[model samples]
Target: MSYAPQKRHSNRAKRWIITIGVFIVVQIIFIAIDGTFLEPSINDSDNVLAKTVRGVLESKLLTERIAPYSFPFFNLFLIVHVVAILIQALGDSISAIFAKR
Candidate 1:
């Protein structure tokens, strides 16, 4: 109930938020590069991964709806950032459990 622990938690939360922001920025940079170069070649491959990705890209939910607003990267970043946050949260929880014991 003391203010000290609450302040410490806020600081920790801020640091994690900043870390996730940086991670997402880096991910977007990589996305830009891949979208410019590698994405163009995805359709030409015969691998399962390629096929899966292509299928997702071509799905009506994306092709007919999301694509209309030019929100592909928007969706991509949203999902990526959520995953990054989840991963960090998972790691933090695991560490906290071990530290408690």
Candidate 2:
């Protein structure tokens, strides 16, 4: 008769919200740092990884049109976030399949 289960579910949802908010804030900070300091210095560098990253940034279609002032690292963060979501979904699906047995 207790509402403990409902309360626990609500708590879990709140935790997820807070965690996601923190993740977004961290990404914003990363983008700022990369744009304000890292990218400018690396722009003229001969590093292969930096060149690859610059190429990837140049290849973004929607991001550039949507936000002209967006940082280069913003696209990278989005890609990473999407991949993380996909991996989490896959893990959840595998766990569900195993749980059914």
Residue range 1-101, candidate 1, lDDT tens digits: 45765665687789897987787686676557643544433355898987787677666766566442243544454556667789878987786677532
Displacement of residue 82 (Cα, Å) in model 1 is 3.5
The whole-model C-alpha lDDT of candidate 2 against the native structure comes to 0.63
lDDT of 1 at 99: 51
Off by over 4 Å in 1: 1-11, 23-43, 67-74, 83-101
* Model 2: pairs clashing at backbone N, Cα or C within 3 Å: none
lDDT of 2 by residue, 2-100 (tens): 777577558656855775787778777665765465654336478998788777776755266534346655656666776776676676567556652
Candidate 2 displacement at residue 99 in angstroms:
1.4
Report model 2's TM-score to 2 decimal places: 0.53
TM-score, prediction 1? 0.44
